[model samples]
Target: MVEIKVKRHEPALIVPENPTKNETLELSDIDDQQGVRVQGAVIMSFKRRSNSIKGEDDPAKVIKEALAKTLHYYYPFAGRVRETGHHRKLVVDCNGEGVLFIEADANVTLNDIQTQIIPPCPLLDDLLFDVPGSTGIIDCPLLLFQVTRLTCGGHILAIRFNHTMCDMLGFMQFLYAMVELSRGAHKPSVMPVWQREVLCARDPPKVTYTHHEYEKGGDKSHEVMNKDESNIIVPGGFLFGPEEIKAIRNHLPSHLQHSYSTFELLCACVWKCRVKALQPDPEDTVQVSMTVSVRENNIILLPSGYYGNSFVSPAITTKAKNLMMSENSLLYALKLVKQSRNRANEEYVRSMMDLMVMEGRPKYKDHLSWMATNLTRKGLEFVDFGWGKPVYSGVPRGTSLVSTFTRFKNGKGQDVIAVVLCLPNEVLLRFQNELGKFVGDFSPLISPTSKL
Candidate 1:
């Protein structure tokens, strides 16, 4: 456990190179949901390059210039988000102020990273460098990023963004755009579009389907609502390669084998494992909330380049007792997870939008909830900057209570999915033991092959 050191420089605002429109943009309901209102971050580790410009000159200056040019086309990101109207609806104030950018140097290399590139990385505060008072939703930069040049010549990009502006896929669009500019592209291949109005509530507002994710909580214990901070919470990333995933899949009954997707199966596994780790009351009902995108294989059809939040989390609830039932418990949880996930159709999204407008944009804040988002195919790991595609790219760590599944290469060079979870330190051992039974060597082994 050698101490990691980072030398940082002054932070500055990077506005678009060419002044764009100074008008405001209204956000969609999916964008400003209370659950996602907080800051979201991603940490990328780029390996050292020999023939690239990013490898020759100062990586910070090169990326800084690229960021400014990239912001020109996607200028909304250079704006700040503020609450407006009676509902506290959020709108982007395109004032051309700029996004926050910082440059730093690290004394570590990419090979030094310890696994699956999950959250809870050491020296996170040093890597991301959150400037004072720069995190507020209103009158604050919509995005902030720090690029740390490592001793081995590689660079790491740690970025924090206002989630209300876009979802994971939308965020990657901006990253890829920046990458293109870093590599000398005049403009992004896919033009950035700003049509948040399309995903807003219907003309009169109508709740056609039930949106259970936002509904009030079920029967929860006292600790569930008012959590005790006495226990230390640890964020851990669990890798599930083809072999590990197959091990869990083999447990399903023959008839139900094909019924579950990889994301649903892993979520159910983690949901049950977490329940066991926490030792919740048997009568207490728990919920696993998963974010489903409405863009692909759904009813919503926005323009190809629209980069905003267009996803919803649909929660599945079941009693703790059922999850403790023998090997069949995984099967039961799998079914519930798959069923809840299928609700991401167009009607559900529209109904959710209407519900938000009709109910004044409510936040349920369910006590017994866990967020399981699928980042296995968000197209982040594939984008190449001047150096090359990142060894690991995705989120940094737990969002207090979140599980992100991302594409990863295990120690054996096998492509896999890493399911990252955050839990109380006391129960981490128990949680690991429970999951360890599924497959041998399930722990993440990339050696910071990444951290978000």
Candidate 2:
């Protein structure tokens, strides 16, 4: 068992430089995120050094300053969420109450922690700023930050965001803006667009396409959380190099081999491998849901800087027997995944919004359901705060609902894509075996990118 010793809890509420006196910002319908409410954290590791200009270097101080400056533009994050219209509407009270910031010390070094590979849950959780017990999801602060100083002259910077506030892209856009401010840039390169009203449902709310991905009729009371831990879900990171990616692509049919991208192919492989590892009943059904950026597919074109939850939940479902019995299961799954991707067009996105407006946010649950999202090209690796770029940057396993795929360098500086998978312990072993067969002798546990 790993222990995280907390030195102190300092709630630093940095108000925006230019505050909005009294205003409430209504979130887009997409912000009504379906699924469980848990604080999601993104952890970034930076090494400490002395600065001649400042005499002493402190990441917390620099980050706080940068955050304050950046929050002036992205002030909605520095506010609190409040309910109106008898809990029908969720809005951000832009009172500039400020975000929660904490300062802590850890006894471990950068090397002591499992960052590049599968990180420890306790250590990762320790990096997250604690949410007050009295605070629930509906009324909690939208943003929180924590700066943890390691014993080896390295520090960990972790930020937690309410999923309802923004998607991964929006969250990173804000963080990147802060990095620019920290680098002495007066303004962000890209100014955020807060025209969430554009996403509001139309007067009539036309639903042209059928949204089969979401259930239509269901009793909300029957939707209870799955508390069973008999088949404990374990998250691990699996690396796939260029060769492995090429091999998976080669497995595709020559007739339409060039139609698929690396992400689609890898999604197919992981989906099939995970299903096979689970050893579900022959007649059981499985579903693989991947998040698609709605900004690219929305009927009303969103600005480049539109930072909100603009994503369509696209899922492909099939029978376990069909997948297990197929000679080329990966290819079969690839075809299905591609089909789902193709369907996430303008019509589908508009239809999804209409579906939510009509059906009232549906909750999907099933043991065979798996979710995946790609953040490989989100510029997370480019986050710099004067000390240097982060050796490791991304979210840890807080929920098994979604597995985020990102590319990071290895010890040898070789580029490898990491698939963060949270599965049963026994299934994890089998899943690694399947992944190894594809990526020639792939190590179940590999060293992270930074040895510097």
Candidate 3:
């Protein structure tokens, strides 16, 4: 392992460039759900720039200033999160308290990191730097960012924020606004909105439809928090390039070849492979939880600027025997995946909010479940920070059974989807063998990139 270390300095707060809101804002029912109450982060690593204008050279200064200005419009991010009443719903105390900011220097350069900066990045903990007390949900900093300067003059930008404040897409909106300011734009193209009340439980809220993913208590499959001991877990990345995708399609009937999508295929294949590898009971329930967008139908229900947790995670399940069947198992899994995803319409969105309240706001459960969230189409790979686009952009920490999809390139210089998968060390090989039956050279676990 490469020895990469960072030396940190005192932390500070960056308030809005201009004070504006002082009233508290209630969090949307979706945002307040126990699944999203924790802290999460996104990482973007950039190489030194040769094109930056003077005064724009230091990333920390540029980003910090841009952040304060960006916060003026998105002030909720500059506030703290607190629960109200015995119900435990959350609200943003828009006290203009500012966000956490830190600057640091890394002993190694970007090149040194690129050598091993694949998904499940080894440098995540050191790069993000989770400060003390920052993780508390009450009155804690809603947003935190760290800019680490490398010996090569490049830097790594890491951001931590309370998920209750916003989901990944919502946070991306805030990020782009800051990037605009870094480019000296007078104002963000899209202003922020805080209409959490838009998603509040309806009067006399009723569940109407059952939420499988939010089912009350789980079974023994979820007994262990992390996936067994660390030594038994194998976290790695897999690329789904054109060849790999085509090979997968070969397994489907011609009539269904183009019916399924990349995202659907990914969930189906991973879930199936994982089930086969785990060798769970033949009748054991195996599920793939997908984060589907409610925003498509939510455009009318939710205004344009509303970006809080606007999606729903619908868990689709089948018997392990069904998924591991000798024939047509992939098709079976795809059907479930599609149906589950399609259920996240506007009505589903409203119903989910109502169900959470009815269930008294339950926390996240992981029994017999695997999470698959897609960021590939989000265009995060193209997010530029003036220094240039990052070679690596994502988070590597989460439940061992959870995976995220991001855009990446293959050895052929072609676009592909990179998925970060975590499996037991004993089953990883078995899992890959199962997946290989559907894919042809899905690229290597790590690809050579010179974005630096």
Query: How many residue pairs clash in all the candidates, one count each?
Result: 14, 0, 0
Q: Which whole-number lDDT from 0 to 100 does residue 445 have in model 3?
A: 51
RMSD of each predicted structure: 2.8, 3.3, 2.8
Whole-model lDDT per candidate? 0.77, 0.71, 0.77
Encode model 2's per-residue lDDT on 6-60: one tens digit a residue. Answer: 5756677778877555688888777764552445667778766644233266778
lDDT of 1 at 49: 72
- For model 3, the superposed segments whose C-alpha errors exceed 4 Å read 52-56, 217-221, 224-234, 297-300, 410-412, 440-452
Which candidate leads in TM-score?
Answer: 1
| 1 against 2, candidate with superior lDDT | 1
How much is 146 displaced in model 2, in angstroms? 1.0
Would you list the clashing residue pairs of candidate 3?
A: none
TM-scores, one per candidate: 0.92, 0.88, 0.91
TM-score, prediction 1: 0.92
lDDT of 3 by residue, 267-297 (tens): 7888888788878788977777788766654
